[model samples]
Target: MSQINKKWYQGMFSNEDWWAAWLGLFFFGLGLLSIWGLDAVGWIAKPKTWEFSNLIHDFSWSKLLKVSSKNYHHLHPLASLFITYFVFLILTSIGAYFQKLNVKKYIIGFTVIFFLTWLTWIIGHEAHLSAANATVKGHNYYQEYNLSWGLQLGGGASFILALIIGLIIGNFFKGFANKIKEAAKPEWFIKAAIVLLGIKLGIMSMKAMGFTKELALAGAAAAFVAYLLFWPIVYFIGRKYFGLNRDSAAVLSSGISICGVSASIATAGAIKAKPVIPIAVSTLILVFAMFELIVLPPLYTNLAPNQPIVNGAAMGMTVKTDGADAAAGAILDQLMISKHLKKTGEHWEEDWILSAAILTKVWIDIFIGIWSFILAYVWIKKVDRGNIKEKIPLSEIWFRLPKFVMAYILVWLIYLGIMYFFPDIIGAAKSGAHIAQGPYRKLLFMLTFLSIGIITDFSKLKGMGKLAILYAVALFAVIAPIAYFVAYLFHHGMMPPVVAK
Candidate 1:
């Protein structure tokens, strides 16, 4: 079986990327069955806020398995935890087997990682840890903390904790980190989560289709315009200002301009630059992206207190990695929603702010394929000053394209179609969609945080201080500000829909 001779459909069975699509849609299909009251995915464990005193006072095996979402059947906490572990283990193990990983080790490693993630999730959910003045079911929870500093980190606290643990393991407990490496697949986890996010978007569109359309258009436009300005400016800085070679400048330009690792690799291949250039640039991109993930959520919330949607869309544009961007968006969503709820005493819809950020980055991700191809053609035709007749592979676009996007769009369109033909069922459908997109989606996100931390070693960033400086300057001086302004132009005054009174 020569590589080029493989059929397109073969990807379904072999490619981890395609497996992401399949797994996403699989859960999404179960969610859709919710319209008929199937309640399939609703059994997934969802952590609840608990203080140590309260937990000890009211401890029970049953209490541990509280179902987080309303309008669904409940399970014992132990049952929920075990079922979640069993389900994910089986599904991910299947993927590992097909991907030719050591399934036994992967299963053992994944079990450890999953439990650790859940532990962090549970601890982070402690009212003092995650809660703010945010409304849950229309009542302000922050009133209870009137005299105390509530941490108010929202769900982001869990993510930060998970990453910190992973980083500790990765940097200090290298042996254990290496053992878990087989299961620390952040991209795979996040991609699958992106698929479930489709369900969230689909449900949102059913309720607010017009807003969804407006957001999609704005996101696409913002990304396109940002890319146009970003590439050339960064390229010039790298070449003329930093005194780098053409190839290094081009690779650095795409790495910073587009979607981090993918963009760097794509541009490196496009310009036929040495593999080492992209590899180094990718490391730099990852470390700096982590810095942004930590800094931006708080900064954006403080700076743009009333502009949640704008901040989110801007985050999508500003953060480089999908993992970091989406993670930041999730944190920002929680933080801004909490702040807004505290201010207005109204419940803002969940996920819309996060979606705005993710959607904008998604647009950039989708464009990177086409952008890379153009770069390839430009390099062959002009940059290299070589033969204009040299062939550029159109297949590169498909290879670079984010397959999880198809799952997102598919669920959204299906929900929209249901809304069009059967308006009465929209309510029923939303409950089902919640199972797919709610706790299950969150589990995958937690996995992304831990995996990202496991892979990030700050020590590796030591020798690349100059590259880090360039990334920082490009980010704060150019990327962050312009991305914010452009996002503001498109998304200003656009707010996530509030829950109806």
Candidate 2:
């Protein structure tokens, strides 16, 4: 085999090629079953009321069946997004195959695509908005359709569903690949994956309004410091105290410290953290994040009503999943709007506030790429190079570097500047007839979720392996959180609050 082909064969899609196991699909089916089983057991039941912000008065199938666009079903708006699960993975894998680039080169390559799309978005807001999710609500069946109402119901639900479904399918396919023989995977695939993930994450951060340079510095500094300190502490408890290795601790710490559990694992993988570490780390982060997602929204609502930006940022940073962060943010925005509803009609202001929070979280996520780079550099310099007396040039950190993410970072910065400076132009452009450009965010998220799902296969997630559960738990869960908290305390509070209100 050619050296390039040889190298590609040992990649992640290669290393963990066993995921074609339908693990994701099975679980998705199981999740449905569990929901059903709960209903059957009377533990949980279908919602009796299908209220649409009190605006959707009619409960008839006809009312719900009203389609918006030819392709989009207003009745089941979620169905469109749900379809992306299959589409996103199939498309991305195809993109990869055709691009035929290695992971490193792929990351470098996406820099170009992300930039062009970003530029197109910058210049073509109207086209963007038209493609977005929106609606014409009817008050008393005579009034125009409620624009916000349609999106909140159809757009949001569908976007979320796409990610969930994507995860299921991606994981299932991955698992099946694992059980099968000689399944091929490309390592550089993650580079492309992360590059796309970064773009989405960067967009989310750009969405956060109050993510000023000073604030970003504070958040990044805090996040980095928190991961550095807290992760090691958790590592000690789990490793020296609980018996785990550096690689395992690295995975858990990375997951908690970054955007989502899966993204964290990918970061760990790029840096070559142990194989099992990413999986274990992601699981731990998910458990904790899910807890926060379910619990923290209400607390923030009651505790920090005036501080939507603060609460939102905290939630994004604290919550492990993008969905949790979004849900928490929306909840906060709604509460703020409700509080102001009686006196002010500035309900839409919450969107901006939520945007601010997402932007901050995205900024923190971007830092993960930087952190991975730093780790790689240090590993090559200190660990790989050994003592200073016997040291080679530390410049080899350049080689260990994942340079492609830099392009993504640069494009995001440029887009952020453009969008911020010309919100009016962009807004008008995005004000498409059917929906606003906001739907673009939804699209980006679906793609991101599907991408994540396609890359993960828990079938290979054996708790015991050359690198075992304890190790991964120690690295991803313990070490990363310790560092994150330490950084957080020094920089600010749990989150950076928006002062716009």
Candidate 3:
């Protein structure tokens, strides 16, 4: 029989895939069942209290100024978590050195690990353990997630660590693991991130973001207005000032108006827009993601300690990339954690601003996939400008679209269900009595990252390099400042608007 004639299931999965799928399902089922059983027992309520006698109960200048987030006594355990990621990274590096394990296996392993974690920590535990003690004391749950010892991914660190290991293997074995190259795929990471976000939301309250019905409506209006107004100006600057061509300009403008460069690059690529366009756009995103990830958290905390939502929303609007958007959110949360209830007392409502910021961005990301399709339609039809006729059928256009986006949309929809369907599932337990539910879009992101490293040649990413670098830098320049400005205008310099508070 011809390939197209094969059954859909057979066409998608080979025997090898079947075995992998079964094993994954088996383990995942066990984890979910175990967690649900715990919920059924209802035995894990927040302990009335944990005994921490050394607790200073203060957010002092000395406490905030220290290299760490903790006072001296609470320092030992906090150091261990950082050390664990550090050691885990080193082990991955050593394994890459001694073993010939493929990236696909590791990627699959990470996916499995993350899945079980989602079932256990998120769906299973309600992501409440870290905050269990504090929640009783009336602290917000964003602080809960951070303190929870799970659900924290920021700074591109894990991705960066993976890159280093991949690079080392690439140098020694030189394509030994080349065949397993799905690690660089951005779409897979995006999908996984969204799923986790949705699951995370299930356990948390959305009211904390101050996303009032009125504020949400107002944000939508401002968002569309900003897109219409600024997109053209951004396009002009790229075309006239930066000397970018039509394709490059489209990618830049899309990154600005819609998501960020990742969205820009993927959309640009799908339409067969110029390769240089995405390269420049991705480079710009990397630069700014780094800046916003590392710098903005501290800067915001220092400058206007109380103004995280304003700052975080601004970053999300401007930074563009979903990952960077979350990183900025984490920063805002951390800063809030460092702030105190009273100037002399412990910080209150820690992570509130950051969580709110992330939710705002999450809401914004819902539009990204839709907006990209619209732009692609606009480019192909109205902006064809030549031999490209406007006569293509809607079916043809639909076929031309990337299938991966369907995966993303499906994931997003599932998350929406988790969030709205049974908010109560999160409030109570996870067993059948309470009820519940929720990859790398990865082959592509691995390719994208390897493409960057190989092209960067593993050297310092200083100075201009190629189409990618210029595009990436331009993206960051456009995104970061705009975020700052927007946040300022909306919240008025961190004074805490009625809606935000």
Please list the C-alpha lDDT of all candidates, in the order they appear: 0.83, 0.41, 0.43
Compared with the true structure, what per-residue lDDT tens digits does model 2 show for residues 414-496?
A: 44654677554443222221121123232343333333333444454454442335534543465334533443353343233
Question: Can you tell me which runs of candidate 1 are displaced by over 4 Å?
Answer: 1-7, 68-74, 138-149, 387-389
Which prediction has the highest lDDT against the true structure? 1
Error of 2 at 176 (Å): 12
Model 2 TM-score (2 dp): 0.50
State which candidate, 1 or 2, has the greater lDDT. 1
Give TM-scores for every candidate, taking all chains together and pairing residue i with residue i: 0.94, 0.50, 0.55
Report residue 125 deviation for candidate 1 (angstroms).
1.1
Expressed as tens digits, the lDDT of each residue in 110-134 for candidate 3 is 3433322222222222332222223
lDDT of 1: 0.83
Backbone clash total for model 2 is 73
For model 1, residues 1-501, the per-residue Cα lDDT tens digits are 433413445566666777888888888888788778777777787886655556688786543446644543555677778888999999999999887789999998899999999888888877677776655764444565342657767677888889788879888988988899899988788888888988788777877788999999999999999999999999888777777899988888888888998899989988899999999999999888888888999899999888888999999999988888888898888888777766676667889989999899889889998998999988888778754468886787887787887777787788878888998888888887787888889999999888888887778788886677777788889899999989999998898888843
TM-score of 3: 0.55
Worst 10 residues of 1 by lDDT: 1-10
Candidate 2 lDDT? 0.41
Q: Deviation in angstroms for 456 in model 3?
A: 9.4
**After superposition, which runs of candidate 2 have C-alpha atoms over 4 Å from their true positions?**
1-218, 259-274, 283-292, 321-357, 373-436, 444-501
RMSD of each: 2.3, 13.6, 11.2
